[model samples]
Target: MEEKLIELVADVLEAEPGALSLDTEFKTDEFDWDSMKGYAILVTLEDEFGASITVDDFIAAKRVGDLLGLVSE
Candidate 1:
């Protein structure tokens, strides 16, 4: 499950499949992550994992693993 979440984050971030680690920060401006990408990630996660995540979840998520934890729960 964590692997899938990592894959999703990598895909959305346009990074290497293995580049996203559990402790990867999602809010770094250096990564160029924006609201549109964040929304896309939320939609993709819900569609792929059948989890009802909201924008608030994205806002609350500080790292890739944080979102994964929410899905796991």
Candidate 2:
């Protein structure tokens, strides 16, 4: 699941899977995560994992690891 999530995120970020990790912080200097990217990720999560992620849940995800919970739940 983690590997798949990483790959999904990397695809959204236009990055390589190897470039991302659970510890990777979104909207940081390393990652130019904007509102568009956030929404993209949210939509992708719902589509890929069949998980319902709320706005609050998305906002709370500061790192890649944080998103794991949204789907796992």
Q: Which has the greatest TM-score?
A: 2
Tens-place lDDT per residue, model 1, 1-73, is 8888889888888888677798999778756888888888888898888888767777999988889866765
Clashing pairs in 1: none
Candidate 2, residues 1-73, lDDT tens digits: the string is: 9999999999998899998999988667566768998899999999999999999988978999999999999
Q: Backbone collision count in every prediction?
A: 0, 0
Error of 1 at 52 (Å): 0.5
Best by lDDT: 2
Over the full model, what C-alpha lDDT does candidate 2 score relative to the true structure? 0.90
Pairs of residues at least 3 apart in sequence or in different chains that clash in candidate 2? none
Minimum summed lDDT over a 10-residue window in model 2 is located at: 25-34
